[model samples]
Target: MKNPVLVALFCLMQTLILAQSPTPSKPRILISTDIGGTDPDDNQSMTHLLMNSDLFQFEGLVSSPSYGEGNKKEILRMIDIYEKDLPKLNKHNKKLAKPDFLRSICKQGRKGNAPFSGYTTATEGSDWIIKCAKKQSEHPLWILDWGGLEDIAQALHDAPEIQHKIRIYWIGGPNKKWSANSYAYIAENFPNLFFIEVNSSYYGFFSNNTEPDTINTSDYYNRVIQGGGHLGMDFKNYYDGEIKMGDSPSLFYMMDGNPEKPERESWGGSFEKITYSPRTIYNQTTTLKDTVAFCSIIEIHLKGPKIEIPSDSVCFWMEIPYGKTIQKWPGYHLGNGDYAIRYIPKKAENLHYRFTSKIAEINGLEGDIVVSNLWPGKKHSTDYPLGNHWYSDKSDINLYDEKIQGGKTVLKWRNVILDDWAKRWKWLK
Candidate 1:
């Protein structure tokens, strides 16, 4: 026979311990992607997200394009595919979000880049961001930015208070090139916001130089992704089954380890805190001595003859190496003979630019700039020392390979992450 008092005490202790243990909860996630755009990699990332939908409480799926033509239709199309494969996915994970729910959350953001001010009129996507951030929850909303920052900027501009309620993980290298204005706005205004800027670090996803040929980008899809499911069959539509889902790191960061500690090692990649992001301003046309870092925002302010014209009418045309054509960027008119145009050089090359506007004096105003291959990291000096912002530490020797910067961070976990993903793929089949 057992003593009733001792028995009760033991049961009480067990109850207390159970009460103290924290319950695991899915993270609140919202993805802003540039899908069906110039890079079809977002399609791959979106497929990965839908297949692993059980892991997150997805609040929104926004189409936010800064350069190419990406829209909500592309997002809905992927969800349609997911809907077809839902039965197979549900067998493994019953918590996967429904297709109707995903379609309901899909919203369209800005069609083009923001102006020099970094924000324009709010769109449906920005409104959705605000709505989702304002939801009552203990967990902060994690925004996985796989595209431009225009929607995020517009959301912040519209609802500044949401900053405290949300965290951001931005994949910002080539995407930054298109969304420089919005990126500058968020970096400058919302310094204390919890943000992770993975500029070059995400290149690690495809850096298979050190990996075996079986897991290489060219062969991985055939080995692991193909013949898995509808999503798997559609994988070949983009990049011909190559794994260039650079934005998937943001998802991986949330999937594998403690997301709150970005500095700590995880399957996604680790990052370091920095005081500032690179932004350079030129009062006049840049000379050969005024070399700017590639992918960093550069602003040229030209003093032109005073003329009465709307600021929106002004445009700056530049000769770019990648596109092999002259591209036009919007210019802004400031009061008292001042005009400005902000540009991000996508490639390391000599750039020639000319301004055009209804104001004849500013029209045909030309300038030259020397762009270096350097990325906007700690190497550049900044006058604006914002609060500690999380970014890839270029100084970390362990995170880089001989050819790719910050590639080793994700490369080290490639086998483990992909093996896990491969198991999930088997579920679909």
Candidate 2:
């Protein structure tokens, strides 16, 4: 007989090869977005999601609003457009979910942000989430929270048994500001919950860090996306033809890389590790932020005894991005310990900007302060809505106060003007 040991070894090698084969299985996704609410970028994200529908095993599309309003009608409106373009989309990939099926699965969740407790009874959307979680699946269903977490929170509250079956990828930053109660409840109570709080990583979609070569939102809409088809035309009709889909990174993260392993560098963005909580024995590493360069402006507020400067000496300092010739404006103390400077970068890449002061007391920090795009878009004065700036909490809405406690300097970057780009591009051919 042939050597039994050699035969066994050959079989083991075959198994190993199959295991490393790079072909990743499709991830199951349930999109919970506030599409029709304050920001319309979620609409752009929805368009991208539908365009790449074959990549995911979509379970649900819940209209979970951030504050007290939602747009189930808007969800249907997109579905209507998808239905018109369904035949052509199917030609590209037959796995695309039928419009009728998507319509059937689409449901309206809670109409606003959650109460202090995070639970405000179960809604149709919340119940749907629970139902989807109960289904048999080899992979954990990813709950992509594009808006408030009230629906997901409710689902978890109602059915604690499904906690292990679902993984949450929350696009925090501004969303968390509006849904603080719900976010706080989840963070405080559900330490074991597999959650990836993407606070600032989503900026990669719009950032020009990989400019010229990489197709950003502005370039994508101007070149390939705008006026391409019905979807393109529809996209141009919103945000004045600008291709700002900030929330789409959640989908991109899953679409490009191995969804089973999020830590790997992907189109969504690379993440650093952070300790979850101090109270929990189950210590876990959470995604801190995207490592991508200058996706957004870095606002540094120098304070404490380290930043104390004498009245006789000039306290101004200059910050220059490492390895770059450009230098941002000098930092000036507004009052008290608040020494602030705003940097609008030319490129989007992770680089340490050396902070140097002419005064001897201000010099010598151990390491270069790590700066990356942690917010949405550039530091413009008109990116998001006037009343709903991304950095300002709706509950604690104060635009005038740049210094809001904690000795941190809050930036007054521009708010996005919805439909401004589309209105400007009305003449687009």
Candidate 3:
């Protein structure tokens, strides 16, 4: 006969054994974030990440405040939808199937728009992130902080230990987002950790008036507008009577399509961006310019009508997978939350280090290998593009072993990118 105390100990050991099963494998990932929360580039960044999930493990997305934006709840809602779309991702693309852990993690908590029911959760972003990150040590979590440094900062404070367990990637800060802040929270807090931050708010896409009329031309109009290749092509297909402008795939595709706004109104938003390189610091604001590091440099310029500056707009990164077809073209800001763009080079520096799945050969388009034709390999391009290059383990996109039929899943413009933010909020447009 065994003693009661000894029996309890045996049960405890058995329970622990059952609890600690096989740990999940660490996955590579590609994270899209709105580092500078309010910037439109955050939207584009999210779309890119979603369309290219094959190249990334994409553990999850974290939203906060960056670039002056105050709140990021709505943005979090949108990403949650993408997080919930995992089943569809598995259905359409045979190359993927999200792990049960990622599937479960996405729903740890979320935000609601209808004010608050008191029973509903306000925001558990920081809490959700820390817990999930610690649970998934097998897959190196690649966290893309696109908005401000709110959730992440809180996350580090909550579970400082997870920092050492996961890889971190940042996309904003330098002038406004202090490097020392990140150092204290990241480098200092979690040593021997993987981290890469790109302050794209300055280096990202923007517009200027230097170029002449482009999309308005008769030749261009006829090619895109009339030839079924124009913005009208997507517009005609999407607006097939659904004028409510509700969230739909067509809406996102036509985000830049201005059936009414003439070509004379389109524009971009920045002038130049400086990336941390092995050695260089020429194209950045003076504040924290020399503090961190520089890796790449890109030209930027903004052109568009000003709107009622309502304090600030929040931004965040995307976690879904985006493919080459989606990353095929260049874009511009149409202002008033209505974006318009083209593939042609209009701005003076339009051709400077422009990266797209098309140019990068992400999906592997046979016979179209532009690797050699790129940089010194192709047309004798520069040796370095942005500078301090870094890839994330989570950014490793792969095909799943599920029985999913259909062709390679690609980004076929969905509604998240199109709906006018101002309209959704029922505010001024």
Report the number of the highest-TM-score candidate: 1
How much RMSD separates candidate 3 from the native structure?
Answer: 20.4
User: Taking the tens digit of each residue's C-alpha lDDT, what string does model 3 give over 158-277?
Assistant: 666876555544543332222222223332234344444333212211111113331121132233223221222332332231222211111121223331211111211111121212
Query: How many angstroms is residue 135 displaced in model 1 relative to the true structure, after the best TM-score fit?
Result: 1.3
Clash counts for the predictions, in order: 0, 21, 83
Q: Rank the candidates by TM-score, best first.
A: 1, 2, 3
Model 3 weakest 10-residue run by lDDT: 367-376
Per-residue CA lDDT of model 2 for 229-339, tens digit only, reads 577778876687676677876776676656555555555544433333111111111123423222223334555344455421335544454454643344445456545
Q: Give residue 271's error in model 3 in angstroms.
A: 22
Q: Please list the C-alpha lDDT of all candidates, in the order they appear.
A: 0.82, 0.60, 0.31
CA RMSD per model (angstroms):
3.2, 16.4, 20.4
- Score candidate 3 by lDDT: 0.31
Q: Residue 58 of model 2: what lDDT?
A: 83
